[model samples]
Target: MAEGRLQRELNRRNPFETPEQEAVLNLLRTGDLILNRFGRLFGEHNITDSQYNVLKILRDEGQPMPSLGIAGRMVQVVPAITGLIDRLEAKELVVRRRCVQDRRVVYVEITPLGTKLLAELDQPVLALHKQMVGKLSQPEVKQLSRLLEKAREVFSQ
Candidate 1:
């Protein structure tokens, strides 16, 4: 069999040290490529991927969430959440409020403006998802997702 597309694309004359190494590298590369495309889309809307993710989390929760809870769900470091919230607050996309019961706790909520922006993005985001994996048959996509989930199970052990 010929070298994989990634090996060829990287111009690597030597084979990967192991199948595990190759699989990990492929996963990272694919993730990076997809993220880059998403970044471009978000850029056009004047937000970063992190910001979009934060908003999405809040929207999905259907209620104000603690700042730490939102940060825990994001790929970003906990400290970085402050800056992200700051930027979102500046845009009036999100607002931060002190938890009435606990002054030390801050809650973040998506504003009407943020919800509106997310609504505007719904169609484009869906289109991009289709564009990304539309070639895969539904079953194939399901299989891929299952396989990835199974692979992640190792981390739980």
Candidate 2:
């Protein structure tokens, strides 16, 4: 049998038990490698991937967002959002305010500094994305996105 790239990379002595397992492992390995690249980029700017994500979400919303709302959109658990917010707040990247009507509720708004940081990162991030998948043609990229969206739908249901 011909050696697959992943098999050679892993230096596996035996073949995968099944194609399904092999595909899943390949997807995970690819994601981890890509994430590591992004991690280094984010590190240079003194923020983790999660922090960048939070700031980006707030920027996209165009208004102050509730803590729970931000938490809902994060990959991390809800409890983790608090610590993430605290760090961003300490850096003056975000400001937290109590809700006017519901004091129990906290709203977070990105600072101009945060917006500036994201703006600076925009080009590098785009370049990184292109670098990661530049080998794939436009059509293949679109198809891959469609396939990923379909795969995610299973979890939504």
Candidate 3:
């Protein structure tokens, strides 16, 4: 008898085919919205989401990493790690070095500039995350994370 929040938001004339369909749609919609917020924030600093992710991964590792390794760690699978690295290289944020023993392997290392940029963004990024889920209680946040992780397991199959 009652319309769901998502249904109303979507301005749907009909109900979702099933609860599963509704839940998945809601998750996707929410994820896109949250991602857009981060995109704006990243744009303010002239960085794309993928670039930020790459820098963060390299910074966290505390050393140079293989280009493929960086690609694997990316949240979304980026098809052209080379182009991404090239841009960062042009920005002088990161450097690509050929391996000494294995000439075929190119390693990417974050420069001081990249480290500084990430440090500058750390607080803003954290604040944005908090702002997005500010309405949720601590327990609710934990529950939501668990539920998301559980849903993600579907990918393993």
C-alpha RMSD of each candidate structure in angstroms? 1.1, 1.2, 1.3
Candidate 1 residues lying further than 4 Å off, grouped into runs, are none
Cα RMSD (Å) between model 1 and the true structure?
A: 1.1
Poorly placed runs, candidate 3 (over 4 Å): none
Q: Lowest summed-lDDT stretch of 10 residues in model 1?
A: 1-10
Candidate 3 lDDT over residue span 122-152, tens digit each: 9999999999999999999999999999988
TM-score of 1: 0.95
Compose the digit string of candidate 1's lDDT tens values, residues 99-154.
99999999999999999999998999889988877889999989989989999999
| Tens-place lDDT digits, model 2, residues 36-95 | 999999999999999999999999999999999998887888899999999999999999
Residue 72 in candidate 1 has what lDDT? 81
What's each prediction's TM-score?
A: 0.95, 0.95, 0.94
Candidate 2 error regions (>4 Å)? none
* Clash pairs for candidate 2: none
Spell out the clash pairs found in candidate 1: none
CA error at residue 156 for candidate 1, angstroms: 1.1
